[model samples]
Target: MSNLDSKLPELMRQATEDLEPESVDLVERSVAQGTRLRQRRSVLAGTAAGVAVLATLGVVVGAVQHFDRDGQAAPAGSLAVGPSATPKPSLPSKAPSGPVATSPSANLKDPTLTTLKSLLQGPSRTFSMPENWGGKDDGFFGASWVVDDGKGGSRVEVLLERFKGPARCAGEPGCRTRPDGSTIRSESLSPEYSDARQKEFGIVSSHVEITRKDGRRISVASYNGVSEKGTKHTRVAPILTVAQLTKLADSQAWQFPAKVSK
Candidate 1:
């Protein structure tokens, strides 16, 4: 045997020689201490891993909930993912009901209004006119037409009046100048202000009135009904545009004055 191996029991006896005999029995206690330390370390590691997993889960859940409440969408593993719903179509607005377009037509002329009885001359008759006139009426100094929109329901009347009054534009709307240097005002009549007599004619009406630099005024109204007492089915959309009404209202025939043939 090697020297150290053979002297191991003698060395143990020499090392324990200074200790009391009652205090030397520690082999079982050392093993128990080592086992307890290993168990405590293992439990601490397991607890830390569990806390980490819970923290990760909390972040994921919070992120998912935030995205859910927001306008944007979350990924597939998120809570209750679904496609966005489409919005429903809304209703159309209440528009001024009328024909899309008035069929092409020429100004209708009554024999009396077809000619302008000029003060300078006897009767000057050269003036542009739109055809398809339903009918015509001659007044003392004004003239009117049924604007002959064969459709009926709305009686689009075009009236040319020798504005007997001054060019008062203080309370008017849409006042502007035309290419011809005449001041014109396009006015819309409120349907709500319609009296019982006015309702007999139509729903709504508009007019174009113009005053020349010479203070001569001419008025034209494209109405829904045939006349102040015309029916609704007489015509629709007043059968004309602002330009057309202004042209008719400011016709040289009325500006020059005939003695507007009734």
Candidate 2:
């Protein structure tokens, strides 16, 4: 009796082995689909968490700008985030302080240019000229004066030169040197620019030269005839004594030009 029962159960298992294959395959497919759905749900939850974090940061930045004095006082390290203002340039209210540039030729105006307009008035003084004589041209270095003889004769003149080189013509004819390094000279000549100058306007000149300790030399000359036939040609000889010429040369007036030139 027990053998038959056990044999009957074994026969039933053998009959279903081939027949259950389709049902077993359907169950396995359902289980794999459920597993794939769970994996997809997990990845979706991670992506959703990332997106929420980025949204929270954007909201925080907006709130900070709203409280930052209308964006005027932006937070530190925020230069790249705003339209910053550029500074305006300002002008100076006063002259800029600095060294002023100067040149070798800037000379002050000398008052002698006006004071010596009328050289001599009436009588001959130490060194004198006619009343009509005045300064024709003058400069920081020298001057020229002239007078008409009232006889169609050559006009006389006085000329000054400052800073002459090493006292040349020191002891020529009619020249003398003093113990104080001062020199005196007298010269007479005839201009043969044709016989008329030689006869009517022979030239006589008296000069005084003084050299200072600083290698500065001043020369003053008085001419008895128009020295500038080339320019201010007066065709008459000037009237003055050798003593007068020497006195004029020794006068300090010649230094005014040199003083202002510096």
Candidate 3:
């Protein structure tokens, strides 16, 4: 008892000597540390949510830039400068002012008697001068021909002379105006020759008279007889019809006589 009691006192004394009051408040420190940890966790969560929102906005902007109004992908150079940009307008072209030019006719040049003869219808043709016409004395241009086309011989004549007034029918009917302001008078004449032989032969004539736009008169006549005042007729009708005589009168082959100034 004495040994045990003495060791117990010494152990109690040593334990009491080592024991002291705590410098910090343990419960308050624990609460403060927990509050700081909660604040750090809230900051990290907010940062992650902000980064996710930024990534989603970037994806939307990229998609809008790649597409066009029709929702299709845009070509390189065909893209618009901006969403609200407008396109430019186009303009129209101009037209010409003056009248178009045209080529002159070959018939406008001078023509020869051979050229006239070539225009005649017959295979075998013979030309003759009715008189000393187309001279400075008469100032006329004319020719007569006997054309035989295997049917019979017939007389054809053409005459050109200066005329002053507007064309008239002179009581003979069937006068008409052509498109180019020329006038035409066409007729068929009964036998009026006084020659007994011509009367016996029974002559007929087709006559065409044309007044040109320049006031020149052209007369074309065809006879069933060999000549207008000749003896014999070889055809029932004139070799040239009234239509043919009109065409021959209308030809530009004749050289126009120069105007004589008074």
Candidate 4:
């Protein structure tokens, strides 16, 4: 017998040993269905091959058109002729126009304005003056300036205070009081304007405010990405200081309104 015929009995024996009785019957039905499906697919493939051969011959005969040396069709002109050229691509449409208005402050490029924007946008923390009603440990409004070093590091905060007192150190032991009953302390940051000494730092932006109970308004001037010496990258400091002084001088909150000398 041929090799397939010889293996058929062994294959049947293995299948009977490996599969359950119900599974063996199911597999026999599946083999019969698969054989029918393969025969149908072969018949369909033959029909498609014959149709493709006929269609190719029809296209070859139909597409042939006689043309003169000038590329013009012959007198018969049976075949459909395509246009000589294709259309060009179109451009995008233009946007609609509207009225243009000038900015209210055309001088936004002013050095002072630019410096103020930089200070406000700098990486710094918010600061406010501590409330003072004679009951608080320090009878002064406090302000803090936060600075960030270039590297990933902790921020340095510089605290400033303004109060109704002399140059005495209140936090120090055995500190003396002023003649007017107020404590002797380091003179206010801006001593000339006692009424709004705290508000001196508000020049960079009008939005800054001082609302503590001591009637002392505190303002803050902050710098960022600075060194410990406060000298390197010092451009931001002087600008912020000058702006705060200017704002304090211009504010209505000052006790003695003084003109900015510079």
Candidate 5:
């Protein structure tokens, strides 16, 4: 053998002379330590996941408890509260059933009222005067009647006054001058309201006004409702038509007393 080959065994013995020998349990200890580390990491991960689940459950239970204490609930995502927090539904109100208010002079008696009721009588029709009239002492007299036919009830009002001359037809619809030197104005299913009450009631009227040559004026109005105000509409249209109102206004029974006939 060569000299270097002969010295190799001594060199190896010198290199290992200060080193400790390998332990028989070294590989087993290494395997057990690695397994323990892996299990610990798995347990930590499982604990974090369980904490998240418990946190979510706590939030849900807290929200439900809060709602139980109060009628209103906090908004969660897009979820809304129940109807217990909302206003209750209400039914529509009915119109008043009391008599209509009027001027203090409404109770005054006028001889002219007697004649007007007689003119309104007809088959299947009944008429009654309400405490809603005035102008008995003045030259003008106004009165109203609640008339009912077999179909429904309606209000028919009449006003007898004095006019300066034949009405100027400007802006007045269906106005015409009769051959008797009288002017007549008629409206068909037209709205005429003097105050908020009449407007709120949605009153529509069929009206006729006549200005005679004798300087006396007659106004006849029919309403779709039982009264001009404080009532709902009982029919689709007024009880009397334009033609019927015109005929009523043209009657001779609307005259005042002889002294005030001017």
Candidate 6:
């Protein structure tokens, strides 16, 4: 007979002999409980083994599926499956073409001259003219709107006037007399000056004489200093020859003072 069947009979005989009449019932119940416990333990062990095998198989299947999708060979203990793979396309190496121009004048309209005129009429906030409407004068043959730094901080000016012969030095105190005995003094001033001299005049000047290509000579001078509220103003002179000045006078870039009416 089978080993398990033989053991069960011997166990039952031992139980019957060892137990009293009342205790025999309790012993039988105990033996039945032990048999149930052994059966449950065997079922649990079998379930654990099945789970381990399934987990190993799942891993192998997944590895094979990945290899098939990538067009590679399936490794041992695995099966390949899925769609065929293709190499990805490369990108272009050069820049795309379109409009290539970038200079300021490329897309802009002409008559920047007229635009300059408007700017001069309503000079920027930074450029404040003298209270007496000093910008207009008969002495100035022509003028052009240069630029202002907008914070009342800096400015550039260009003016043209007819050569009224030569300038005399009588009005200015520091004017030097030339050896020619002519009252014509070089308008150039020394860079170094005493504190007393600077305090007397609210500005500094740099002067030079330039002869135009047409044989007309003119004096060019620059005046720079602080204005009201400590704003800096710079005035440049003799920007053009008398003939050139006349032409610029008609240009749109020139603006006469409002008070002057022309």
lDDT tens string, model 6, 196-244? Answer: 4444543433333332322223232223432211323343322223333
Go through the candidates in order and give each one's C-alpha lDDT: 0.49, 0.44, 0.62, 0.34, 0.67, 0.37
Model 5 agreement with the true structure over 143-259: per-residue lDDT tens digits: 667778866677887777764555444544566777888777766776545445545677677777777887777778788887765677777788789888888888887766423
**Residue clash pairs of candidate 4:** 166-185, 167-185, 168-184, 168-185, 198-217
Q: How would you order the candidates by TM-score, starting with the best?
A: 5, 3, 1, 2, 6, 4
Count clashing residue pairs in model 5: 0
lDDT of 2 by residue, 132-189 (tens): 1112232223333343435333333333334434544444654556666555554333
* Alpha carbon deviation, residue 72, candidate 2 (Å): 83
lDDT by residue (1-262, candidate 1, tens digit) is: 6999999999999999988755455767778899999999999999999999999998988887787678466654756555354332211111111223122443344432343212112122222222222222322234334444354423233333333444445544557665656677665543422355445544565666667765565555555555433344355565556676665655555424333332
TM-score to native of every candidate shown: 0.37, 0.36, 0.49, 0.19, 0.52, 0.22
Best by TM-score: 5
Instruction: Tell me the spans in candidate 1 whose CA falls farther than 4 Å from its real position.
Output: 1-112, 115-140, 153-172, 178-180, 188-202, 258-262
Backbone clashes, each candidate: 15, 9, 0, 5, 0, 1
Per-residue lDDT for 182-249 in model 4, tens only? 32212112211223421342211111223233323333333322322222332222224434533432
Off by over 4 Å in 4: 1-135, 145-231, 234-241, 248-262
Q: Please state every model's RMSD to the true fold in angstroms.
A: 20.9, 27.0, 32.9, 29.9, 17.8, 28.4
* Candidate 3: count of backbone clashes, pairs at least 3 residues apart or interchain: 0
Off-target runs (Cα >4 Å) in candidate 2 are: 1-119, 124-140, 148-174, 188-197, 200-216, 221-227, 230-236, 256-262
Error of 1 at 87 (Å): 44
Model 3 Cα lDDT, one tens digit per residue, 1-262? 8999879988999889976747567768889999999999999899989989998987876666666445765644465444443321110100111122111221222233344566784556554432212433555555555677767777776666765666544554466777888878767754634445445767777777788877777777788877655356777888889888778878777666645423
